[model samples]
Target: MRCEEIRELLVAHADGELDDVERERVDSHLANCPACRRERAAFESTGNLLSLLGPVPGAGRSISARVMATVRGEDPWCGHIRRELTAFVDGELTEAEARPVREHLATCAACAAESRALERTGDALRAWKLPSMRIGLARLFAPPRARGRLLRFAAALAAACLLLAVGIAFFVSESGTATPPPGLLRAMEMLDPATLEILDQDPGLLEIVRDLELLESVTDEEVALLTLNGSGG
Candidate 1:
């Protein structure tokens, strides 16, 4: 094999990946060619170095510990003191609690700078003037137009509920109940004299009423057609 071809196989040869025939060819070339022998030697040295430096089981954890230690900054004591600096600035900490933070700030330039920033922030907040707010319940009352809409909505809702109750009674009767259900009796008792008189005058209205399921299944187009026919009549 040519030196170039032999060099290509050198890495695989060093790794013992080459078959016996390919290894013999490469070995014959290396024995005669000093340049190829040097190339093979370089590959072998690199493999040996890589084997020596191959991953130790917990080397990753050791490296991570070092990286974290570097990232946490120069002072290990600053972490706890930095947390309490806010409380220290607010005068919320006792002298015992504040002493360590004070001593830390005095020695550590980074912590001292943070403490100064906290003090400035506290001072700015204390100096800030908030606009006075007038407490009034009058705004909670609805406007006249809104009140009218609300009243109309409430009346329409009440009427819908009454119609639903009457519909349920009609549905029960249609199912061949000779006497009204106890639920219907209670509903009738709750009705005013005027409503009872209206129902008495037009008992057939209840009989003509469709089931709620049928009424709900009705489409807007069907309602429009019904309205048009009613107007024509």
Candidate 2:
């Protein structure tokens, strides 16, 4: 089987849930593929860890002694086999690969103890239950008061832009000439008549600038309302 197909079967194979033919296919693949073998080990370890909720007996006295010896660098296979025992018990290893591990564990008191401890850990994992979260993730992270203020500020800003657009559209449709809207006429009157004549020569440019100024004015007025409401605070 391909790596992806073999990976999908790894969990079921580890659990002895695969049929003989499927198990043999995964075994054949694992025998030649070290990367798949490692992934299979991880799946088995995760399954063992999740099974920890169940009541499992404590590790044998020999387990701690062996662990201490391995920590002191007294055993050569200590690190490697400790990493693989979970996979071995799950029957995830091929005969050739598992033989050395079996031989070592038989003679090594410390590794055997380590293996028993792992079995207990797996057992406890099987019985554990995770508690449900009471609040949604977003609500848990952001307070409602802060969220409400932020939403109000955003709504006010949007309302200002929308109102400005509607007002500009109505004025453009009605004026249809060089004459400016009441809002723009007030600002235009402040300029010299020569400047106004030059501005009137290009109604398009004047209209664009007028619309931009109106949008800015509307936005500022909305922001002022937010300030009065203490939303900015």
For candidate 1, report its TM-score: 0.34
Give one digit per residue, the lDDT tens place, for model 1 in 110-193.
Answer: 788778866654443333221210111122123545333322222222333355455444543466332324564344325564
lDDT of 1: 0.56
Q: Model 2: what TM-score?
A: 0.26
Model 2: how far residue 45 lies from native, Å: 67
Candidate closest to the true structure, highest TM-score: 1
Q: Summarize candidate 2's per-residue lDDT along 3-43 as a digit string, tens digits.
A: 99899899998899999899889999999999999999999
Q: Which ten residues in a row have the lowest lDDT in candidate 1?
A: 129-138
Each candidate structure's count of clashing pairs? 0, 14
